[model samples]
Target: MNIFDLLLEADILVQISIFILLGFSILSWSVIFHRVFTLNIAHKKLKLFENEFWSGIDLASLYQKSLSRRNKLNGAEQIFYVGFKEFSKLYQMKRCSSETIISRTLDTMHTAINIELKTLEDYIPLIGTIGSISPYLGLFGTVLGIMHVFVELGKTTNNTATQIIHLQIIAPGIAESLIATAIGLFVAIPSVMAFNYLTTQINNLDQDYNNFIDEFITILYRQIFLNIDSVLNKENKHEETENKTCY
Candidate 1:
């Protein structure tokens, strides 16, 4: 029989269970598709930004470019911009030592990473919820359907015709009830797979961000030493010129 026929014949509780499962299935699929697209974009954007960042370009130029695309800035770019801006401000102020500037910059990047993680993980729980609850929803429908069939069977008398008719009814009802379980599995398997895959991707990105932070700190340290060296060299050169003139 058609799905409409089975749905029409289902007990009220079974119908309710089926409808609820259907709703869950729709919402879970939506979350899956949305997350796929968003994460893909995030990965691509990060790769593009990383290539630019490591190309030996100046931080000021990178920061200006990032600012121009502020609305479209991805996770890595956003973190870099926030950390760089803070670093520049603190360095120029000359109020904090090099260590303090690095510490504060790391803190800013950590905060931005947390925010990016939250955005990346949005709606993930919904997929997990669907995976966990869909099977139970289907089982509930099956249990309700079985109970309904037993109740109808009990109503029939000892007449052979009545018993045979009830048996026929039971067969169709049982088949219809099992459809709920099938649908539940259909909803659950993909959700579980998607959840696992997305989780792995996010974790990788998290590690990438952390590594970048450490590498950036090292770059800042080198810049500080280079500046010190340049100043010292200028002083030595000036002193030598004066001594040579006196001699």
Candidate 2:
């Protein structure tokens, strides 16, 4: 008999199990497609932003360009914007030491990274939960189907003139029960694989954000020292000019 015929004849509980598996399969695939698209976009945006950042552009100019698209900034760009804004604020105030400014800017960037990570992780746990539970749900349906087949067989043997068993009588029922497990595995395998692949993508993006943060902070530190030296040099040149006038 065809799968549809078997499903029609299957026990009610088994039918429910199959329907649930089908639902999980649909939801899992939906999440897989969404994440694939999202992560791919994130990766491309990050690469583009990184290339622009490292192409000898000034930080203030980069910040201004990013500001134009502030609402739509990607992961790496968002980090740069947040970190640079914080550094600019603290540097302008000049009330805090350089160490304090750097520390505060680092904290702000870390918070931005966490927020970006959370956004990337949306709906991922649901996929993991479905993969973990689908097999057990299918197993439950299979066990119930087998019990139903056995109960029916006992009734038939009681009515028969001779105590005999037939392969045809049991084969269809067993086949129906096994279909639940087959569906479960079908749903689970792809969900698990997609989960792993998406998770790796997230981790890679996270690493890129961290590396950028470190490099950006180093640049900020150097700029601070350069400004200090420039001020000291200007003051020394002014004093030398005054000494020449006095002579």
Candidate 3:
């Protein structure tokens, strides 16, 4: 007969274990599909944002674009917005030193990065947990099923003919219980594979974010240097005009 028939004929405990594993299987698959789509979108957005960010657009304009889509920002775009917004505020104040401004900007970006990464990694642990424990749970059911079969066999003190008939029933019953182990492996294998693959994608996204942060910081430094030089040139022009007037 089919596995469904075997399941129907299984002991009560084995049935319960199978049901639990089935639930785990369902939930794990749901998470797997949801996470796959979500991560795929995240990676695509990351690539698009990287291209736009490095196209030599000014920070203020890029920041404005990000602000307009505040609801959709993710990965490097979110971090850039956070860092640039803080940098703009502090730079406008003119009181904070460059070191303090950069430090605060970096801190803000780091915090945003952590938040985005955490959101990306949500529910991944559930997949991992299911993968790790489903097999052991199935084995527990298998062990119980075998123990039950042997106990039944032990009680048969009748003639070999009756005992043989008893074993005919016991054999299928034990095989039915081992189905739990099979189901466990079924649930575990895909979940483990999905967990590892999704984690790797998340890690790659994080690395992209880090690289953008470093590049943005360098860009900010160059902007700050140019601003300082411009201000110094203005002061020099003013001094020269004053000297000419005095003479």
Q: Write the per-residue lDDT of candidate 2 for residues 76-194, one digit (tens) a residue.
A: 89999999998888666533455667788999999999999999999998898899999998898999999888777766645354335544576689789888988889988999989
Model 2 C-alpha RMSD to native: 7.4
lDDT head-to-head 1 vs 3, winner: 3
Candidate 2 Cα lDDT to native: 0.84
In model 1, the Cα lDDT at residue 166 comes to 81
Q: After superposing candidate 3, which stretches have Cα over 4 Å from the reference?
A: 229-247
The regions of model 1 sitting more than 4 angstroms off are 2-4, 159-161, 225-247
Give per-model TM-scores: 0.86, 0.88, 0.89
Candidate 1, residues 69-157, lDDT tens digits: the string is 88876689999999988888776743344556677889999999999999999999889988999998899899888888888888899
lDDT of each candidate versus the true structure: 0.83, 0.84, 0.86
Prediction 2 TM-score vs. true: 0.88
Candidate 1, residue 234: CA error in Å?
Answer: 17
Please provide, for model 3 over 19-116, each residue's C-alpha lDDT reduced to its tens digit, 9 standing for 90 to 100. Answer: 99999999999999999999998888888988998888888899999999888877788888889988888777534455667778888999999999
Instruction: Say which prediction, candidate 2 or candidate 3, comes out ahead on TM-score.
Output: 3
